[model samples]
Target: MDELKGEWFETWFDTSYYHILYQNRDFTEAERFINNLLGYLDLPKNVNCLDLACGKGRHSVFINKKGFQVTGVDLSSNSIKEAKPFENETLSFDTHDMREVYKENTFDVVFNLFTSFGYFDDYDDNLKVLNSVNKMLVSEGLVVIDFMNADYTLDHLVEKEVKTLDGIDFNITKSYDGKHIFKNIDFTDQGKEFHFQEKVQAIKKEEFETLLEKTGFEIQNIYGDFSLAPFNKKESDRLIIIAKKK
Candidate 1:
């Protein structure tokens, strides 16, 4: 279980490096994409929404502002701590492992966004997160999974790149496993070096569909991009799946 062989969660924090990435970000694209998704999903207001692995509460805040009651959970304390002050009556964030089963059938929607799946060393452990997602959804409840278009990503792979942000230099490399992509980033700053790694499940369209079916979810829709367009292999930047509890 090479995937389970690493401290992925801790390294995930280092890769995103909350304070830095957020500060350097351009939210315009994210704002547009999310707004489009909200329209496509057409979820009703006043519903309970759970954002699993909701890092830094960016999506949670956006959704809450759109009138949904949102609860966000992640495995990183640093993210939870960073997200806390942004919390309000309609939104909350906490630290929780996605692999654990939560209170069953309590949410109207459970969303795992931004390629957040496929990291555990054990394949079954990774699958368990889907079970947990299903358990959190009410009858006929919806779950939306938004991940990178693995095929597209693989084809467009950039083997190595150097990026300097906030005076830190990141030497990054990316490669693909059979079902996921592995990224290693070596960070250098002020004569010191730190390595960060992340593994994202590189599921084919059929693979994700099969996983959803096996998890007792009824496939409702699949989109290739955030604009809710039909899925086309050579044309989309994202793989967005919408499913409902059976």
Candidate 2:
């Protein structure tokens, strides 16, 4: 096993075990969220869309099915390779960093879903991602960022848990400081023990508003969850923001 240091995602996300650990993520819920978003936006057919940090391209495939020209990009080569099989006339997958602009003024919609942001330790890197998203979008183009509500998450924190899947026991421990949340995962497979960590910044609504405004995005709407309910800071399970390029 590799040492769990530096950027944890670079090693953890590239391994097959990472896929196994998260294979049970609710795809149905994600699909429904995409459907609701599409219905609300009512975008014209064949519009260009970019799925930022699109691991395995599930959401990208869903968007492509709805008649959009979708391009899914991720930093994980393993994920991009797995997503390539789904590519067709209007759908494509590539390996790219979200902090850099892949294409300028090209996409009608740019989606950064499933709390994919705030991985970098440096706060400025997160702003760079927003700038990249802004640069990629056309005039008045939409950017949907689905993030976790920091306050709610810290209030409802799960400190520890154990999950047994496929005959492997995963011991998970979670902790949150004022600035970031950390998940420490330890498990043994075939008599070998391994440990990994996931760290995400606890970005609040006000921070997002400031970042969007600074990036030239006008806030259009905010939702509390995948259901698209209006955001309530104290009670929402998720923070979903819809902003338009100014």
Error of 1 at 99 (Å): 1.2
lDDT of 2 by residue, 49-85 (tens): 9999999999999999999999999999999999999
Give candidate 1 misplaced runs (Cα > 4 Å). 1-6, 14-23
Worst 10 residues of 1 by lDDT: 1-10
Instruction: Predict model 2's lDDT versus the native.
Output: 0.93
Off by over 4 Å in 2: 1-6
- Please give, for residues 9-78, the per-residue lDDT of candidate 1 as tens digits: 6655734453553476656777777899788778889799998988888989998999999999888888
TM-scores, all models, native as reference: 0.92, 0.97
Error of 1 at 86 (Å): 1.6
lDDT of each: 0.81, 0.93
Query: Once model 1 is optimally superposed onto the true structure by TM-score, how far is the C-alpha of residue 78 displaced, in angstroms?
Result: 0.5
Model 2 RMSD vs true structure: 1.1
